[model samples]
Target chain A: MPIKSMYVTYSDSIYQFIYFLVGDDELAKDLTQETFLKAINSNPQFRGESSEKTWLSKIARNLVYDHFRRKRLLKFIPFLHEHEQIDYTYSPEQWLEAKNEQYELYEALGKLPHHYREAIVLRKIEQFSIKESAQILGWNEAKVKNATERGMKKMNELLGGERDA
Target chain B: MLDSKLRSLERKTLDEETKNSQLLKLNKRNKDYMKKQKFTYSVTLVLFGLLLFVFSQTITESPKSIQSQQLTNFELGEVTKAYYLYSKRADRMYNLTSPFYTDKIFTTDPAVLNEFELLFKNSEWLPFNGDLTKYTTSINYLFQLENGESVYLKEINEDGFFVNPNTMMQTKLAQQSHEQFVFYWMHIYMGKNEFPPWKIGLLTILLLIFVYAAIKSNKRGTIEKNSSLINLSGLGLAFFCIHKMNEWLGVNHLLTLLLIFTFFMSATVYLHILIKKQEPNWKYHIQRIFMANIVLFVLFI
Candidate 1:
C-alpha cells in the first residue's frame, strides 16, 4: 500500500496506542509519525504476516522502548527533568469529571514499569487479545497472560487500591 | 471501575488535526526515504562500476600496447622521440605519461642493437600481477616509436619490463647505462612521484557502503535474505574497515588502537539500533564513519 493511504487507515489507532503509552499528545503524535517512518525506513517490505495494525503496534512499542531508554539515560544528570504535561482531548463535562481522577490514573500508568504498562495498555485498555499482544510484544502467550494479570493488579495498587482499603 | 476507566481512557482518541498532520509528516518522510534510497542505489552502482572499470583496466592492458609488443622485433629505421622516467611510482605513470618522449636506446652505442637482440633472446620476464591501483613500479623506460606510440611497460624498473602475468606481452628490454638513466630523469616533464595507495582504501570504502546499503534495503518480513544480509554485511563492514584502518594508520600504535576501538563502538551501537528496529540513522553512521576517516587523514597526513 502507498504509505499515505496506509497511514490514513491506521494512524488514529496507532496514535491512540502511542498516546496511552507516552501520556502526551505531542510526543505521541511525534512517535506515531516515527512508527510509520521507522517501518518504512527500516522495514519497507512489511508483508503483513500479522495485520498491519499489529506491525504498527510493534514499531510503536519499539519507539516507546527507545523513548524510555533515552529517558532513563537522562536520569543520571540530576538537573534535567522533563515536566510531563497531561493534556487529554475531552468534552467539558468529561474533562471536569476526569480532570483529577483520570489524570492521576494516567500518571500512574506512565509510572508503571514499561513492560507492565505496555501489557496493561494492550490487554485492558486497547483490548488486544492475549495472542495478539504476544505477537506485538514478542512474548509467549503465557507471558502475555501473566503480564496482563500482574499489570492490572499493579495498576490498581498504583491508584492506592490496597492503601485506601 | 478499573475496567470502566480503562475503557473510558481508550475513548479519548487523538484530535483530528493531530492525526492528519502526522499523516502529512509520514507522507513527507516516506517521500524523503524513497529519494534517499534511489540516491544510495545510484551511488552504489556508480562506485561498483568504477571499481569494475579500474580492475578491468588493470587486467586488460591497452590493446595498442599489446599490438606494439607484437611488433617489438619490427626494428625501426629511426626513433622519433625518447625520454625515460626515473624513480617513478606505477600509480602516477598509469594516471598520466607524457607522449612526447623517446627511448635513449637510439642515443646510445650502435652495439646496443646486438644487446637488444640478446636481451630479447634470454629475457626472464618477471610476471607481477599486483593491482595497478596499489602496485608501485620503479618504471623508467618510455619510448616513442615511428608511429608515435609510447612503449612504456607498467612494471619497468632500472633494468627491464615486468609483464602482467595475465597478459601475453613478451616485450624485452636491454640493460641501459647509468648515464642514460640519469639523462631521462633530468627531463622537464618526468620526475619522481610519491603515490599514496588511497584509491584502494576508497574502493574498499565504496564496496562497504554498497554492501551496507544492500543490508539496509533488505526487508524484515523476509527472514532468509534479510537477517543474514544484515548480520553478514555489518560484520563484514566492521571487519574490512578495521583491516583498512590498520593499513591506513600503517603503524601499530596508540592512535590506531584508539581509532579502531572508537569505530567498533560506533558499529556496535549501530547494530543495536538495527536490532531494536529504531529509526535507522544509517546516513548518520555513514557520515560519521566518513568524517572520522577524513579527520584521521587530516590529523595524520
Candidate 2:
C-alpha cells in the first residue's frame, strides 16, 4: 500500500506503543513520525515477511531504543543533561494524574527494565498475540511469555513497596 | 485490578491533530522520495545508454550498406606515419589528424599496426550522435597514410566505445583492440598524473556532502537526526563497497551490503559510546566529519 494510507492507519498505534516505551507523549509522537519515515526509506527491502503493523511496531520499538541510547549518552556528559529539554508532558506523576487511575501500577510499570516493559507493553497494553509480539520484539514466544509474567510480578512488587513507603 | 488498569493504559492513542499532522508529513516525504527515486532512475538509464553507445560493435561492411565514400578497413592500406592520437581534452580532438594536438604517441611499429589492421578488418560502423568527450574519456587512433592523408579512428574510451573517423558514425573496436589501444595510451598518459574529471567531480561532491552533513548534525546537537543526505551517501558507499568486495571475494552483493551496513550501525553505536564517555569536543567533531566523509565517499563513489 502507498505510505500515506499506511501512516494514517498505523501512526496512532505506533505512537501509542512508543509512548509506552518512553513514557513521554510528545516524544512518542515524534518517534511515531520517525517510524513511518524509516518505513518509507527502507520500503524497497520490505519483503512482506510480516504484517505491516508488526513491521511498523518493530520500527517504533527500535526508535525507542535509539531514543534511550541517546539519553544514556548523557550519563557521561553530566553537564549536557542541564541543557537537555525535559518534557514533563508524560512524567510518571503527571501521566498518572492525567489518566486518573492506576497511579502506583503505572509508575511501577515505567520503572521496569526495558525488556520487561517491552514485553508487558506488547502483550498487555497493545494486546498483540504472543506470536505477533514475538515478531515485533524479535523474540521467541516462550521468552515473551516469560518476560510478561516476570514483568508483571516485578511491577507489583515495586507498587507494593512504594505504597508501604 | 492490575490487568484492568493495564488494559485502560493500552487503550490511548495519539490525538487526531497529531496523527493527521504526522500523516501529512509522511505524505510529503513520500512525495519527495518518489521524485528522488525517479531522478535516480533517469540517471541510471542515461548511464546505461551511454555505455551501450560507447562499446557498440564495429559495423561489418556489407554489400547493401556500402557507400562510395564509406571508409572500410580493406581500402585503408599499409602506412608509414601511423600515430595513436589522443588528447586529454575534446576540443583538441580532430586536430590530432594534423599532428597539431598536444599529445600524440607513435604506433607505426609493424606489430601494433598489424593488430589494428586485423582488429578493424571488415569493421562495422553505426551512425552516432553527440561529442564523446562531453560524456566519456576517449582517444583517437590516427593511422597517418604515407601520402599525408590520416585515418583517425577513435579508440574506444573508458566507457568502452569510441568514434569513427568520419565523425558522423561511431564504432566499437574489438575487445582485443580496446585492450591493446588502452595498453598503448596508458604508457603516455599515466605520467600526466592528474585526477580524471569524473574523479574530481565525485570527490568534490563527497566533500560537499560530508561538510553539509557535519554542519547539520552539529547544529541539531542531538544524535537522533537522520538526514537523507547522510543516509543516501552512506548507502551509496555501502553498495559500492559491496560490489567491490564481491569482485574481490566473489561474495554475494546483498550479503556484503548487509555486512557493510552492520559496520555503519556499529560505528553509530560506537559514536554513542564515545559521547557517553564525554570524548573531547574537538575530537568528537573531527571524528564526526571524518566518519561522515568516509560514508559519503563509500556511498557516493
Candidate 3:
C-alpha cells in the first residue's frame, strides 16, 4: 500500500491501542504521532512481514511497554484520577454505560498479572486468533490460551459471576 | 467469574486505542530526524571550505630556497678574487709543475700523494674543490690560509678513498687561494641584512586579526562566513612574513619568541572554551591579542 493511505488507515487504531494501554488521552495522541513517524522511516521489509496496521501497532505496543518499564524503574505513579473527570468524544449516555463496564473490567484486569491481561486483551478484545495473539505476544498458542483462560476466570470471580459461556 | 469480564473488556477496547496511538508516535519521530540532518550538513560544508582554503594558500606561495644566498655568492666567486676553476679541456690531466705540488714533476707521485692536503689546509681562501674524496674527514670545517684567505671544506668520501686530515687541510688551502676572487664576489652579494621593524609589527597585527576572526567565526556557529577564510589566509601570510624576517635579519631568537606567543595564545583560547563551556568573550580575546603584540614588539625591537 502507498505510505499515505497506510498512515490514514492505521492512525486511529494505533492511537486507540496506546490510549487503552496508557489510559491517558494526551500521551496516547503523542505516542500515535511518534509511531507513524517510525512506520514511515522503517525499512520496506515491514511490508512483507505483516500488514501495515499490525506493524504500527507492534511499534506502539513496544513504546507503551518502554513507558511502563521506565515508570516502574523510576517509582512514578501516574495521576490516574486527573483523567476521571474529562468528557470523552463519545456521548455521555453511551460513554457512561461503556465506561462503567470498562472501569469494572479495567479494575479486575489490573489485578491480574501483566501477561494474563495482555494475552486476554489480544485474544478477546483485539479479536486476534490464538496463533496471531501468540505471535504478537511472543508466546506459543498454548500459553496464550492458558493466559486468556486464567484472565477470564479471574475477571469472572472479581465481577461476582461465573465465566461467560 | 471476574476473568471473563476483563477478557471481554480487553476484546472490545484495545483494537481502537492501539491504532490511534501509533499514528501520533510516527509524526514526532520524523521531525527529530529532519533537525539532525540539517545540523550535519552545515558542519560538513564548513569543514570542506576550511580544507579548500588551506590547499589554495599552499599552492599560491612560491617555493622558498633553503640554501643561504651567502653560500651561493661564495661559490660563484662574485666577492672573493680566488676561486677553483675546473676545466674539462685545459687542466684535465695533472699540471705536473705547479708550485703547490711536491710531486715527481708530472708522473704520478706515490710519495707526494694527492694535492688534496694542500687544498684542505688552504680552503679558507678558496671555493670548494667539488671533490668528494678531498672532504673525506669532516664536512663543515673552516681552513685559513697564509694568504689571509678562507675556505669552507666539506668531507666527501669517495668509494674506498680516504683523505687524511693534514692532506685534507692542505688541499682546502690550495683550493681557497685559487678561488679567493670568486668567494669575495659571492660574499658581497651574500651580505646579511635586517628586516625593517615596521614590517614585523605589521605581520604581528595580521596574525592577531586571524586569531580574532577564528574565535569570532566559531562563536557565531556559522564559520561558513567567507571572512573566516580570509582571516585564515592572513594567518598563513603572517607566518611566512615571520619566517622571511628571521632569515633576513638573522634573528633566530625572534622566531622562537613568535612561536611561544602563538602557542600560548592557542592554549589559552582552547582551555577557556573547554572549561567555561562557552565562547570566549571579547575582553579575553582582545587581551590575548594585545599580549601577543607586546611579545612580538619586545622580541623584534
Weakest lDDT window of 10 consecutive positions for candidate 1 chain A = A79-88
Per-residue C-alpha lDDT of model 1 across residues B95-119, encoded as one tens digit per residue: 2332311112223333443333344
**Most accurate candidate by TM-score:** 2
Model 1 alpha-carbon miss at residue B116, Å: 29
TM-score pick, better of 1 and 2: 2
The sequence of per-residue lDDT tens digits that candidate 3 reaches over residues A1-165 is 434466677666666666656656667777767666655444222423445555666677666665655555324434233322222232212343557766666666555556666676676666667866665555578988888888777767776664354
Ranking by TM-score: 2, 1, 3
TM-score each candidate.
0.45, 0.46, 0.34
Ranking by lDDT: 2, 1, 3
DockQ for each numbered candidate: 0.19, 0.18, 0.09
iRMSD, per candidate, in listed order? 7.8, 12.1, 16.0
- Candidate 1 accuracy as lDDT: 0.56
Backbone clash count, each prediction separately: 4, 9, 109
Q: Give per-model CA RMSD.
A: 14.6, 15.2, 22.1
Q: Which ranges of candidate 3 are over 4 A from the true structure?
A: A43-47, A74-99, A163-165, B1-301
Worst 10 residues of 3 chain B by lDDT: B85-94
The DockQ for candidate 3, computed on C-alphas, is 0.09
**For residues A1-165, could you state the per-residue lDDT of candidate 1 as single tens digits?**
557777878888898788777766678878988888877764534544677788789878767766766777435444213312222232222443457776777777777766777788888887888877987777789989997778788888889895233
lDDT of 2 by residue, B1-301 (tens): 5666677763456788887787888888988876776666567558746743432221111112212345433334566555554443422444433222234456456775665566666557666666644643465566776667666555554544756535456666667776776675575444333447886777568658767875554332223355776667856754454444333332223334444654675576467546443212232333444365355445543
A33-108: candidate 2 lDDT, tens digit per residue = 9988988766543445678888788878777756766776434444323322332233553545755446655677
